[model samples]
Target chain A: MPTMQPLMLPPLVIETQNLTKAFGQQKALDGVNLQVVPGAIGLLGPNGAGKSTLIKCLLQLQPITSGSARLLGREVGSEGREIRKRVGYTPEQDCHIPGMVGCEYVTYCAQLCGLPFQAARQRAHEMLDFVGMGQERYRKIESYSTGMRQRLKLAQAMVHDPEIIFLDEPTNGLDPKGQAQILDLVNSLWKRYGITVVLSSHLLHDVDRICEQIIIIARGRVLVHDTLENLKARRRGAAEVVLSGRHQEFESACLRRNWACEPLPNGHIKVEHHSDSLNSLLGLLDEIKLPPLEIIPSPNALEETFVQALEISHATA
Target chain B: MPLHDTSYQHWEGVHLGLWRRRWVIARAGLRACLQGKWMRHLIVLCWVSALGMTTVLFLVGQLLVANSIVVKWMGNFNPALQAFAGMLTTWLEQHPEISVRTTQDVLFYYFCIGLMRAGIFALGMAIPLLITRDLASNAIIIYSSKAVSRGDYLLGKFITAFVLIFLTWLGPVCAAWFVGNLLAPDWRFFWHSRVAVAHVLVFGAASMTVLSLLALGVSAISSKEKSTAAVWFMWWIFGGVLAPIAVQTQPWLRHLSFNFDLDQLALAVFRPAHDLTIAQTNIPILGDMLRGVRPQTLASLATPELQGAVAALLVMLALAAFLIRNRVRPE
Candidate 1:
């Protein structure tokens, strides 16, 4: 028997194949297959979506059920320490040592990551600075705000300068500004330091802004895992363009031009076309000179896509 | 491979992390013990209680040893004093190494024994408090990084607790011995009293091992507040005033009491000042044994050795590892 050799190069720095986790009678993660590339990959899911479960399985903090995960060419379960050494993790919950100074806590974490004392200290200082926590580095963690505490957690995670970092809802309890600051720090860490980030969050906007690829999961199963482009492609069938001209004229003109256009009740024409024909609309506007005040491509309904995935997951379940 | 990294902390063994974690936690516990007014007050109360009990016991023992007319006269009216004196006198005669007189001797014998016994109890009591604090405050994860194994983390905590227990017992023992010697002048008899005191200390340390383990087990099983309640309730059931009563009321129940065996062991080990007519028993199989044999007795019976300490330490470290493994359920 002859087997065909594989063709597509795997983009993932970390990938899971039929990964599953169960807690007694309850299954926490059920047959999850996730491939995370070298850029920011968002792990989005609802409360029981198994985002945390997947992350924990990857870290080997929780045991896997049936399948396996690969991180940086190594299997997650058996090579967790090796994976963890190269990958940082900021837990969803606020884990703070009240009496220890921020620097002390980070330094200890660095040491645990196998850095020597002087080097750990140096790296800890650099990490604090990287997270914009330099001024408050000497202060005890008990005095830190929720934002500062979150930043401290982030700093400790990166103190060893890991190759990949897992941030589980890093902005979970933070204010908007705090969230922005943290996201900014996360973005910089990825952009400047070349750290691959697996940011797990329920907030779609956060995922939309930072992630090049998104995996939306619900109820312990993956609903979708694709590039943002693929997701937009998935939504292309219902594409609409709003026009601010005489609806009748625009409709007739579009019909004559063989463009699928429908007139709305509010004197706005909804022009429908394949994503490939978006260029044709622009070209039509230039030729016809039916200059409307605005020609806006309606934003792709991501919230709808999310709800649709949920519906699909629910129906399939 | 670079033999010399030219940096701090060249080694990467679990001990390196365990040592630092142990130091930090021990310092934190010591600081808490010293700084908090309530803790300081608690320590004061402990010292006061131990001192009061020791002084009373000493006075009563002295009265019995002297066989004073006042004591006899008192005994005529109250048979309680007569019985107590007679019992003490008998107790002293079996092993006479407990009551040292010279400044050095008294301090060595009484202080060491007092400190070891009282301090062990106090320190053992304090351990649950520290564990509960860490659990309650949710700060335990701060010092315990995911970088180290759970075994290493628990070993660190156990090491810290052990060191704290040692300090608690040692300090009191030194103080008690110093005070005992100051009150008395005869050095030879005092020296003889030292052996019993030393044995009591070893017994106290042995007791502490069990107490700390039980405390940790309780802490691992319950929330901090519940853990505190469990520790106190277990202590009352096993160690405090009710234990003796239960032992006395039901003769068979005496075998189950930790304190009963501990007290017996202490008495046997610390053969008081007037003790003489030594008796030794050697069993063919298990050697000369003390009163009760419970599950902990096997461990208690083993002759104290470096090898035994290492084995006990491994068992403790293993138990701690098991506790941590089951503590956190996947969310």
Candidate 2:
């Protein structure tokens, strides 16, 4: 391992302070502040949500209008080469070299990241194999299928064995099976190899399946930044209870107990469990003489959170 | 549980420095260029001229040695061969100036022709394959995403073109020079002509730099190889054909042709000493025919040919660099 200089001390794997990017009068990234620790982090946003722009800015592929970003403890703009040596990026676009085979393309990428020729070649094969590209590795990139191209892209990004890999839409165009396979591969990248992954995608399920931490961005700003567990935990203890009889009486009884309640048209009442225990709610239901049919706890799904965040962001604008 | 062991293995190998990364790009590009059949054929053709020149030198050396067998054989030739031999002797005698005084002069001539042929090949074939293909595919993003910068990528492509031109230009000249020395009577010819070797190096280096920059600049602006190749041929062919016509009507238009400008530069760089006069009579008929189309009367031009060539080459290099700098970006 290379020695880390003391002057470059930063514990976070990715940190940005008030990062802003603008083109003429329009700003693409506005006062974005992010501090990410090393793990499987997900960047989720709708189209034109600045996810790709943020990744580019952090990679130093594009200059930021203002503010600063550091990756793996090195500043982005000034030390882009040094930072890139330790970080890998798979761009969203189809950026394959013409007339190069899969192995050759990956080997060239590894060489570009400062690996010697022999080492790069060896690593390229290993990465190709790991990506499940078998005999097809010898085929020219232009001849590969869409799935193979995505796999090849992943292989090239990981060929150097960098500390972290930024995957932008790794499953952009794929069937369900291919998507599942790629997601599985991404999950293993972190779980088995100890490599940190930052998966940027609009697919909530993909991020939910792979990333432990999530950052949702909307309209060039980060709407929410928290762990998936925490976000879901905040929405816990809320339940929708169905009634068999006396729905109005049950709603009145819940209101008297200071529980927030709203009766639905389907004879189900939504209630926030503010009391100490569910037993109390059971006792209150019994006292109301309303037969409880069913009760289901409603934890906030990542999809709902993403949508709500976008709505709030739009409303603010 | 995971479906498969898509594990990431740690790379325990040593990491190399960025100093030689540009060579990696150049090597890959060179390999890609050599893979094409047309480029390979052109490369082979580049050496054909050198071989022809070397054969001529060998025959001249034999004639100078007064070998009895060659003379006897010439005396017994058919009418056509006898007529050619008699004409050659008459031409040689009429122009006492038409003599290879030293092997250096022959090597310099071969090197100039070799460089020109190689420049054309590189501009037409190698530059398009190496640069335009990458741009057409938007592969610059992949290259720049790694530790390599945009400048490094451009420099790498430049080196690719430079190496191809070197092989096409200098490689043949060196081979011809070796043969010329070996065919000479003794080491005296080699010793006297040694300075020409440095001249070849300087001339080859300057020409390759200018041509590589110009080709790469044109490649940078255009995305498709075919479009770039068309633009390149149009510039060279039209400039060569039209500039002469324009210069005939307006003598001041001589500097308009890049080919003429490069030729002027070559003349200035390879200008022989005043005592070593050229043997024009000994040159083949084809050489004499081609000279009529080439720009003549370097001294009569409004500006010094050498200065105009240098200024034009520098301007081309600057334009190429500017276009490349603007085009090679991730955005």
TM-score of each: 0.68, 0.83
Error of 2 at B126 (Å): 2.2
State the lDDT of candidate 1 residue by residue for B1-331, as single tens digits: 2232212112232223435644544555566555556546656665564465445434534553436554677688998877766665564455444322222232333544455455445554555555555665555553333555445455555555565555555445534444543443233334654654565457557755654554455456544655565664665466556555754586434434344444444443443221211121221112233223454443432322334334444555466546645662322
lDDT of each: 0.62, 0.78
Question: Candidate 2, residues B190-303: lDDT per residue as tens digits?
Answer: 555565666677777777788888888888877877888888788888777876697659744656566777777666666642212242324546346534532444233213
What docking class should model 2 receive? medium
| lDDT for each residue of candidate 2 in A193-286, tens digit (9 for 90 to 100) | 8788999999898999999899999878999999988877766656779877787787788788787888777767888766434677788877
The CAPRI quality class of candidate 1 comes to incorrect
* Leading candidate by lDDT: 2
> What's the interface RMS deviation of candidate 2?
2.3
